[model samples]
Target: MKKTILLTLLVVSSFQNINSQEKREKDLLTSRKWYIKYMKFGENKREISDKTKNENWMLFNQNGKAEITTQGIKSIEDWNFGKKHEIINISEDGKFTEYKIEKLNESELVISRKYLNKTTTLGLKK
Candidate 1:
């Protein structure tokens, strides 16, 4: 009986820890609006000197909705994360695309997507 109780407690605590971590990640992601500050395109990871701030930005809501504006075009979308928070999925117009998260922190985020053997990475600042 003691072993069974201990095992159950451990299992419950593990689940709670996983849930808390996911929640923390989500909260960090939704805490602020992110502006595209850099791009890993032709050059190495460098700041985009030509674009103005807020010209290309994204905002995530805690309710699973997202707002993305690029070059003055705004889109309403839905977003979610993978089981381990290694990937994020954004859905627009009933279609969803998965992006691999290269880095995420309180003030910066980096994500990459692949298409036809080509990969593009975007760095965002809070």
Candidate 2:
């Protein structure tokens, strides 16, 4: 009886984990499109539509495909939420970039990445 109880608990726990993962994905990806509000590269912050005249946007699809549009050019990529939805990984042309999720909600998505002693934080709005 004890073993049976343990097995049942394990099954329930597995289902809970699956449900949590699905919920996370739905909450973060359902919007389909997110526009970059700004990006902070270390101490410098670049606002959207600044003097640079650059536009950046991201699209997340239910099929695990993502697209990044910059300067009217779109790059196709595959994307996935990291374990526990703590990060987002985007792969394109055999290159992968992982962005650690700082905050995600119905209207906002914030992520950051650190490389070569520089940290870039990007804020997005739906």
Question: Which portions of model 2 show Cα errors greater than 4 Å?
Answer: 2-11, 14-18, 50-54
What does the lDDT come to for candidate 2? 0.82
Q: Over all chains combined, what TM-score does candidate 2 have? A: 0.80
Q: Estimate each model's TM-score.
A: 0.86, 0.80
Model 1 is weakest, by summed lDDT over 10 consecutive residues, at: 42-51
How well is each residue in 7-92 modelled by candidate 1, as lDDT tens digits? 99999999999889888888889999989888775445667654576778889899989999877789999999976678889996
Summarize candidate 2's per-residue lDDT along 28-122 as a digit string, tens digits: 76576888889899999988874322458888887778888877788889988776567788896878789998988888889899977999898
CA lDDT, candidate 2, residue 126: 77
Best candidate per TM-score, number?
1
The global C-alpha lDDT for each of the candidates, from Candidate 1 onward, is: 0.85, 0.82
